[model samples]
Target chain A: MKYYNWGIIGLGEIATSFTNSFQQENSQITAVASRTLSKAVAFANEHDIPKAYGSFEALLADQAIDIVYIAVPNRQHIEHILKALAAGKHVLCEKAITMNSAELTQAMTLAEEKGLILAEAMTIFNMPLYQELRSQIDSNRFGKLKMIQAPFGSYKEPDPSNRFFNPDLAGGALLDIGTYAVSFARWFFTSQPKVIASVMQPFSTGVDEQSATILQNDVQEMATVSLSFQAKMPKQGVVAFEDAYIVINEYPRADEAKIFFNDGTVETIVSGDSTQALNYEITNMIKMIEGETSNRSLFLTKDVIDLLDQMQQNWTN
Target chain B: MKYYNWGIIGLGEIATSFTNSFQQENSQITAVASRTLSKAVAFANEHDIPKAYGSFEALLADQAIDIVYIAVPNRQHIEHILKALAAGKHVLCEKAITMNSAELTQAMTLAEEKGLILAEAMTIFNMPLYQELRSQIDSNRFGKLKMIQAPFGSYKEPDPSNRFFNPDLAGGALLDIGTYAVSFARWFFTSQPKVIASVMQPFSTGVDEQSATILQNDVQEMATVSLSFQAKMPKQGVVAFEDAYIVINEYPRADEAKIFFNDGTVETIVSGDSTQALNYEITNMIKMIEGETSNRSLFLTKDVIDLLDQMQQNWTN
Candidate 1:
């Protein structure tokens, strides 16, 4: 059995969630790092990690860490990923992979030169349930796909101090929740659609509080997506085909899904474990590090990056 | 008192909702019309309407019917409203007043020549809750107005036979629910903003199932909106200002609203009656007919029509 030692480069909420998930999976969190030594020490102690570093650079220097998970804010993703790649460590970076595709391209090039595995940590893209959904579509079970709608949002009391609504942190609904919806649209469609229309609400900090986007391909196939930080939502995505429809209950990172056929038959697929999707991404990264695969699926990562770039350019906040 | 007797041009579901709402108010339904006399007569008997006509033309021919409410499908709205105006009757048409603004301009010109009230029946625009929300923003109670997020959708089994998804009838989210969200954004901002981004999904009948939109004005204020028919959604809109937020529980004619101030004071304003917004429009029209007001609120009606027209032009459906 092959196992890779993992190091997390941030001690934020997401990073903690990933660490807890990894612990449940019997994966090793070899080290943890944060800007503050006390925070890093507390997290490391809480997670029973073997090492804690005072700074990101120190964590990158740890030779035993085979892979690094970059869970920093959006603006810092590229910088941290490039640093980890230069250090000869495999990298799994969070969504909105970089500030834009230009940065993504630069990181991809650097990773290729270093012969290091670099994957955008979009766990939903590799989920068994999503794969099954794609299989069903590929098999033409739903007939010709016509439309897709997904909305993910939540009401968070405005706190200027939170990274989510901070403009300097590249924070907003689009870069955050919208990225998930847009990525799903791009993944299923496999083409860049023109943004035919859009409406957005900018927060006081010049970041989007909520946004709705309408994208269409040359053939007029369309997808509508909504993301917000202004209301409570039951995360969902529905794909309507000519003969049937697929309803994803908890979309973007759905664990269970159902396909409703025109013939009145229902097919259900449930991902057995309720584990966070980060576990799957991290597990995949370890496999790649052990020479199990050539590189993270280029098509999926490119799709995410391209979609993010287009969305960021399309939206000012 | 110039009590202009009203003729309803369609006995559809929306027409029924409107009539039910009007029954609670002072408005009188003088006549009801449908293509089938049996259907019109049944509706008249059920609602206690005074007159039933077999055809729309018959209703128009009746010299006693002073005004006409065109509640037909979107594609027929232009034809019916134009004919009603041409028949020397004041017109209060449904939202998406016409297929496009060009038709609106033509109708407005005709109404002007005839010295009649040609108002788009946008109930939300006439609602007391919306007016209160506007007042809060105007008074800077919520500080500098920033963003508005609203979504309205429902999950209903898609039947190709239904008018909602039928492209031939100009049915889609944009013309249906999208019109409400889009119009609300424009109304709140009080300006026509350029569409910064958009995404849409087409239905089996070549109509939009869902649409997400983002818009930004020259002043840098933005509004985000989402509209769909593919999922069940809570009816709501959140208007976020710099220092406070107003939460509207039932949007598109909210029955009640809560305003939360930064100082921790929450004020709940109950909406007038459970009546649909159309009654408010009917009341306004009645007042206009009585010569209480010189002309229709052109700014409100024009802004709404212009917004819907611009959004439709970008339709991917």
Candidate 2:
């Protein structure tokens, strides 16, 4: 079997992006599977993959497929994650990883029991700019880490049948976009933070269309996160300090940040290319599987899922 | 007496900014006052004023003063406002117009009873661009108002004895910078919105150092306001709609906005001068006193204060 052997279990838009990104530097797409044989064959032919399977189980049974990239819809994450892990293949699923902490814990436990790797394909956990900023923060280059603001908004049509507002699809701003905002926040806080307060405006389908949440870490460093589905807000992230602040515009895939100091000097910091965001996630997943790095990003992802769970729980009242 | 005679009840930095701003167009400053006679006399000489008062009482007794601009500290706003209104002069008090809604209501009622005009020096209610934006919204220019964001932050030293953290002076982020943030949000909302959620970080002196509040209007339009006293946040405000959104940088004194449409068209809107933000407040106050404009700004100020009161009350619990 070739090193870094990979198979895709879904042929959606996200799956195409993943296949293209992973193939940019290395070609290890051993096979691809879709519910329909024609669709899988078409995708595999277009991507020049070695094989295509009509059933996910057939691809999982392939001895050459050591890892499975689960690109299915949100509602199918846990089932696919467990199936791939139980089939002795490492799993890297798209965000959000699961519906709640319970589901995530079950999957995590199964992966641990099987001695297999499992991670959420949250770009926030893999972005090189965040990793660079995290080290700068730890090095005390700026003063105390005090405040962070993460705002993400994407305009989606109000049609109730649309996937953005469809309740059966686990559709809402929270799972769709709030995961990134919360993950960005969780990565900055010193420790796990609690959801101090949360409020949401629900769509006609009883899903959160827009929401605001406040989080405070044990050290009193607070974070404010705002999300919306009907408006386009700038994806600006601010990490403020006592004597300076770091601002990253279009922060989700940002490779640059401007640091404004109280002493009237501004410094700009740059990291890896933003266009390679997906490739960065794939590279990091490979490193974790190869035992080259610790699974800290997975821990942060777990905390973020917990935060999303609590925020949703809060809205139920 | 001049048609628009004005007297200032404080000799602080804000009072100086007010003097400079009001003089840019027309010179109507009739007198100046300070508790110290020498300070008052120096201020009068520097500004070329006709009279100076050693005490606030002496300024209220000046028959030539038809209006009073109270620029005292936050804790002293109510006292000077009441004194100015009771002396039969129209009052324009610095924001955080009063300690609480009760105090503001008392002053508002007294002003109504005494037939004197009273208004807060909140530039948000008087800025021409906001008025222009409001009319545009009324004209259905941008499908529907969905979200508004107002964030303000000003860093101060962590000294507990400093006025920014002193409880005796009613010094806090809420009264100081939050007034601007909240006022910006309140001006855009269709109706009075309740504080759905609030969280704050207190300073060593027990005054709020930073805070976040979520508000939802009657039409389900949502707003997010964040404030800080120990960090500098961009005073950028966002007014988002269904198909387009307006962004104003340095929004507290903004005279321009950039409208971004979904179809990739960008339009710039400009009105008035930012340098004359305080002058706009002065001009609008004069218009209200002259029976040309209604006391709508004052009503907005009252609503903003009520929201601030509720946020503070939440912190105590």
Per-model TM-score versus the true fold:
0.73, 0.98
Binned by DockQ into CAPRI classes (incorrect, acceptable, medium, high), candidate 2 is medium
Q: Which ten residues in a row have the lowest lDDT in candidate 1 chain A?
A: A230-239
- Relative to the true structure, candidate 1 reaches a TM of 0.73
lDDT minimum window of 10 residues, candidate 2 chain A: A19-28
What stretches of model 2 exceed 4 Å from their correct place?
A: A24-27, B24-27
What's the C-alpha lDDT at position B229 in model 2?
Answer: 86
iRMSD, all candidates: 6.3, 1.2
Report fnat for all candidates as fractions from 0 to 1: 0.15, 0.59
Q: What is the TM-score of chain B alone in each candidate?
A: 0.92, 0.97
Per-residue lDDT tens digits of candidate 2, residues B127-199? 9998998899889889888888888888898888988899998989999899989998888888999988888
